[model samples]
Target: MGRVAGKVALVTGAGLGLGRASSLLLASEGARLVVSDIDEGLATHTAAEIVRGGGEALALRHDVSKPEDWSAAMAAIEQRFGRLDVLVNNAGIAIARNIEDTSLAEWRRTMAINLDGVFLGCQEGIKLMKKSGGGSIINLSSIDGVIGEADLAAYCASKGGVRTLTKAVAVHCAEQRYGIRCNSIHPGYIWTPQTENYLRDLGTLEQEKAKALSRHPIGFLGEPNDIAYMVLYLASDESKFVTGSEMVVDGGYLAV
Candidate 1:
């Protein structure tokens, strides 16, 4: 029951979807949580849920793209937890525009939230985790990170960056003997608020759902828990020897 007993985990985008799911699971498994999201109300709700479930959590309003916000969030975590054990870089945005159709501002916005956020999380997380004898950094990439989606050019680019960045962070931590492990998770069409919004923007929700389901090969899309379980494993001592790895949880979408 106590998979990560006494550990401290900070999950970004804890407002909803995969982030919310991961935070709940971590808390259930005995980790104290720092739930940070751009929406303070959402973060507070998540923290309240954890508290109601007999877990410890702290909620904060944070903008991952801002260095100042990162600094402030880290300071708050340090004050409340005294040490950090896990960092989940789960906040991101996806643009459904191909390169040809994508505006400069659109591309920049996508990169700012999806790519820059993870980069900052890694940098700031490493600094704090190093002080606490090192920990795990989980970056949320996507199947698009490994494969390309013509309409998701910017998302694919940012997630691809996350995949490679995770490997680099892992190797650096190992070389520095910091006891930290970093890995990326590539998920395939998980049905979340973000994904739903992305799809609804493109066309009819039912048609988009059918198209997404057909690609999975498993007959259906994945749930947030599917990814949350992986997060649990990575956060636990079970994955001490696992680092710089790309864990694909894609209902075999990449196989076809």
Candidate 2:
């Protein structure tokens, strides 16, 4: 049997990048998924792809930053699946700006989507999971959250918030016996389409790729699968004893 057989998962930002990859991987491992994104078309496309691959999936246009949307999503899940087993808070944005240059609006927007969104997902997901025994909550953080970057101040702050928030949620769940486990996954420079766009905008993809690889001791940038592997481990029953931890999938970037 698959590792996550008979489980149900909700993946935010499932339209692309690591979220899309995680949604696909989880489904491949036999989990029915609720793939949600701000873009309805993309969410629908992702769900269709899973179903085409003979996996079960549902598409929802959900803005994770909104509490009402979270309620609606939980309601939909309850009506259809009856229980939620996993929640992947993978919706985030990176604003390229130094501390001095970062606007207040940009900072708030980053916090809203990156930090507030994850908070809402965890809060609502925990409530539903409590009803069904317990569940896993995975927050997608970044290496920027662990270390520092030149022009990603707001992004760093938002992700750092996620790191601590995961711990707090884990503690609360454990104390309350909510049966919910919370953890954060910090990824280094993964070559997703978003990063590709950044490289393309630099007008020197080869140079950017070389620079990114040079930072990693592994001599190569990570792929979406790297993060997905960790997500799978944390989402499965195999990680029953693991909670309130930060799993780094950085290809040794943080090691050096």
Candidate 3:
């Protein structure tokens, strides 16, 4: 049997990138997936892929920053599966701007998706998970959450918020004996379509790749599967005791 066999999972921002990778991986491990994304087409396509692979999945158009969407998403999940077993809050936006260059609107938007989204997901996921006796909640953070970046003030703040919010949720669940575990996964420079766009904007994909590899002791940039594997582990019973922790999959970038 697969690691997460028979579980029900909801993954946000699952249209592409790390979120898509996580959804596919979880489904492969036998979890019935609810894949939601702002991009409806991508979400539907991903769900189709999962179904073709002999896994169960559903697609929903959802905007992670909105609480109404969260509520509706949960309601849909309940109607379809009757119970929720895992929630992966993986929707986020990255804006490369210094403190002075960042607009208030940009900052607020980032916080809404990256920080507020996690809070809402945890809150709703906990309520549903409690009914089922337990569940796993995984929040997607970044190396920026643990360290400082020159042009990523807002992104860093939002991720840092996620890191702390994850701990708070974990503590609350433990104190109330909810049998739920909450944790954050921090990744650094995983190559995704968005990252490709960033590299193209820089006009030097190879140079940027070289630079990213140089920072990591492993001498290679991480792939989407690298983060997906860690997420699957956290979602599975294999990480039963892992709560309120920050699992870094940074290719040793943080170690140095």
Candidate 4:
């Protein structure tokens, strides 16, 4: 029952979707959770949920794209938890515009949240983890990072950057004997509010939903838990040998 008993983990964007799912699952399995989100209310709600479920949890207002915020978050975690064992760089945004149509602003925003955010989290997380004998770092990439789609240029680029960045960090940690493991997860189509918003922007809700479903041979969309379970494995000691690896939870979407 206690897959990660007594470990402390910080999850960015823990208030929503996959992040929320991962936080809940980790807490359920006996990990103390640092639930972070840009939205203070959502963060509080998530932490409250965990606590109500008789789990250890703390909520923090975190803007992952801001280096200063990362510093403050680390300070808070160190103060409250004394050490950190896991960092899930799960906070990200998607801009469904092709390169030509995507504005500079949009592209920059995507990179800031999706790519820069992960970079900052890793930097600060490594510092905390090293003090505690290292930990696991999971960066959430996407199937688009591996197989490109024309409309997802900016999103794809940021995720692709994350994919490679994870490997580089893994290599450095291993060579330095940091005991920390870094990996990336590439998820295909999981039904989340972000996807709903993206789908709304694409076209008719039902039509686009149907089209999206057709791409995945699994015959259905995924839930946040689909990705969360994998995050748990990576966060746990069971995956000790796993580092610098890309775990795909795309429901066979990448197969076709």
Using all chains and alpha carbons, the TM-scores for the candidates as numbered come to 0.99, 0.97, 0.97, 0.99
Residue 171 of model 1, lDDT score: 97
Which 10-residue window of candidate 1 scores lowest in summed lDDT?
A: 211-220
Range of the 10 consecutive residues with the lowest summed lDDT in candidate 4: 144-153
Tell me how many residue pairs clash in candidate 1.
0
Write model 3 residue lDDT over 1-256, tens digit each, in one string.
Answer: 4999999999999999999999999999999999999999999999999999999999999988888998999889999999999999999988877799989999999999899989889888887888888999999999999998867789999999999989999999999998899999999899998777755655588887777679889888889999999999999999999999999999899999
TM-score computed on alpha carbons, candidate 1: 0.99
State the local distance difference test value for candidate 1.
Answer: 0.96
| Between candidates 3 and 4, the TM-score winner | 4
Candidate 1, residues 16-64, lDDT tens digits: the string is 9999999999999999999999999999999999999999999999999
Model 3: pairs clashing at backbone N, Cα or C within 3 Å: none
Native-to-model Cα distance after best TM-score fit, residue 8 in candidate 4, in Å: 0.5
Clashing pairs in 4: none
- Number of backbone collisions per candidate: 0, 0, 0, 0
- The residue-by-residue lDDT of candidate 2 on 1-256, one tens digit each, is 3999989999999999899999999999999999999999999999999999999999999988889999999999999999999999999888778899999999999999999999999999998999889999999988888898867899999999999999999999999999999999999989998777766654589997788889999888899988998999999999999999999999899999
- Cα RMSD to the true fold for all candidates: 0.6, 1.2, 1.2, 0.6
TM-score result, candidate 2 = 0.97
Q: Which of the two candidates, 2 or 4, achieves a greater lDDT against the reference?
A: 4
